[model samples]
Target: MEEAIFSKLRYMKKVLLIGGAGFIGFNITKFLAENRNYEITVADNFFRGKMDVLLTDLVDKYKIRVVNADFTNAASFDQLDKDYDQVYMLAAVVGVKYTEEIPNELIRINAFLALNTLEWLKTAQCKKVVFTSTSECYAGTIEAFDYQVPTPESVPLCIDDITHPRFTYAVTKMLGESGFMNYSKVFGFECTIVRYHNVYGPRMGFKHVIPQVTQRFLKKEDPFKIYGYDQTRSFNYIDDAVNGTVLAMETPDVSGEIFHIGDMTDELKIEELIKYIGELMDYKGTYEYESAPSGSVSRRCPDISKAQKMLGYDPKTSWKVGVKNTIEWYVNYINTGGDVFE
Candidate 1:
C-alpha cells in the first residue's frame, strides 16, 4: 500500500510556469506549492526574474524544478517536456521604464516569446494554459473612446498611438491574447486569458509605483511628487491575483474565455495612494502635484463580475491593508540592507 501511494503521488498532474520567478509568477508558484500536491516546474530566463534567496528557498523546500533558459528562442522549448497538464505563460518584459528606453527590444522579446510558445503548444500535449495579460491593452479604449470605468473582458483592445513607445507593451500583449486563444481553438487545447490591473505586494521589485513610493519615503524627499495625482486605478493584491489565475486554470468549461483578474472595489486616486504611503512611513512631507506621464491612462478599473460569477473569484485585500503589508515588508527588507533584485 505504501509503495502504491508513493507511485501515485509521483505521477500526479504536472504544472509548468513560464517566467515563474517574477513577482506575480513567484507568488503563484508559492501558493501552488503550499496548497496543492501537483508536480510543479518553473521555467524562466530571468530577464527580470531573479534567482534570489526567496525563490531558492521555495525550490529547496518543495523540490520544485527550475529551468533557466531563454524562452524567446524556439529551440529552448525543446528543453521542456511535451506533456504538461497546465502551463502558465507569465513571461514578458514588463515595466514603463523599459517601454520608454528600449521599446524595440520590448516588442521583439515579448512578441517572439508569445509566438514561440504558441507554436510549441501546437505540437505539445499540454492540457491547458493561462496567458497573463495587462490592463494596458484596453487603456486606449477608455482614453480615446471613454469606455466603461469598471471595464469588462469584452471591451475592444486599442492602442492610442502605435508610433508611441508606451504602447509597445500593450501591442505585444494583444498579440499574446489573440495568439493563445486562436491557437488553442484550432490546436484542440484549453486556453484562458486574464488581464490584470495594478497588482502590488511585497517582493514586487522596485520598478512599480508602490515600491518606488516606498524608496522615496525611505530617502525622505521633502516635497513628494505625486504624478498623475488625479488618475485612478484599482490595485489588486498579489495573493488575490494569484487565486484568480489558479481558478481560471482549474475551473472547467472556461476555455476560450477571458477574465479580468483584479480588485474592482479598491479603486483610488494616485494622490490617495501616495499620501497613504507617506502616513505609513511616518513622513511629514509636503506634496507636489504633477501631470501624469504622456500616454498614461487617466483611469483603470476592471469588471470582475464574470470571474466572481463563473470561477467564484473574489479579492479579499483592501488597498489600505494590502499597502500596509507591502510597506512593512519593503521597510524591513531595506533596513536589513536588501539589495534590489530584478
Candidate 2:
C-alpha cells in the first residue's frame, strides 16, 4: 500500500461487497443478485453478522460467492480478486454495546478494517466504491454547536469527548471518512459516502433499540424504562437504506460525494418509539425515563435532500409500517423457537 497513485482500473461487470453477511449487506447482496447480472461475492467474518438460513438460501439460489475470513488483517485482501468494478465497503464493528464495553478493541478493529481496505485498494483494480458511514460522525457537531437537526453530509465531523467510551465508534468512522476520501483521491478510485441514520428493520439483530425494546415487551416488563426519552432520531427502514446505497453505487459521475441516507419525515422521540413497540406487543407496562448513557448525542437526524436530488433516492417506508413489519418478524421468530443472538 504505497502513497502513489496507480494505473486506472478497467471497468467490468463484477461487484464485491466486503461485509455482505450483515443485515444491510445481506439485503444489498440480495438486491444485486435479483436485479442485476453482475458476478457477486460476499466477503465477511460474521462476528456480528450471521450466516443464517436466509443468507444460505440466497447463496444457494443465486450461486453467489462467499469468503469467510477475519478482515482485521490486511493480508486477507490477498484472498480476493483485484478486478471488481463496484465495491461496497460495509465492514466495521457497529452497535453501542461494543463501543461501550470494548472501546479499545472496537477502535483497533474498525480503524484497521478501514485502513487495510484502503491499502488493498492501492493495487486492487477496483473501480467506483461506496463507503458506508454513520450519522454519528456528525453527532457531536449537532450536540455541541446546536447544528441543524436534519443534518446533512457537509456538517463537519467531530467527537464530543475523545476520552469517552461511547464516542469511540464515531471516532473510528471519522477516520474512515477521511481515509476513504484521501485514498480515493490519491489512487483515482471513484468514491461516494452515505452516512446512515437510524436504519432498522427485521433481522437488524438484538443490539439495536427496536429489537431490545421488543424483547423487553415480550418478557412482559411491568415498568419499562425508556433510556433517552426526549432524544429524537429518524429511523430508516432497511429496504430504503438498501435502495439509497445501490443508487450511490450505480449513479454516474458522482465521485468524492457524501449523502445522508435516512428518513427525515418521521423523526420521533425515544419514548414515542418504545411506546409504539409496546402497544404493538399489547404490553400494559408503565413507562419511565432514565438518563441516556454518557456521551450520547441529545438529538440526531439526517438531511437527505442531497441524496434525493442527486441519486433519485426516495425512501417510502413510514416508521409505523417499518416497525410493524419488524415487530411481527421478531414475534414469529421467537414464537417458533428460532435461535438469535441477543
Count the clashes in each prediction.
0, 0
Question: For candidate 1, lDDT tens digit of each residue in 70-122?
Answer: 99899999989999999999999999999999999999999999999999999
lDDT of 2 by residue, 67-130 (tens): 9988899889888999899999999889889987899999999999999999999999999899
Give TM-scores for every candidate, taking all chains together and pairing residue i with residue i.
Answer: 0.98, 0.95
The TM-score of candidate 2 is 0.95
**Error at 69, model 1, angstroms:** 0.4
RMSD to truth, every model: 1.4, 5.7
Which structure among the candidates has the greatest TM-score? Answer: 1
Deviation (Å) of 149 in candidate 2: 1.3
What do the candidate models score in CA lDDT, each in turn? Answer: 0.95, 0.90
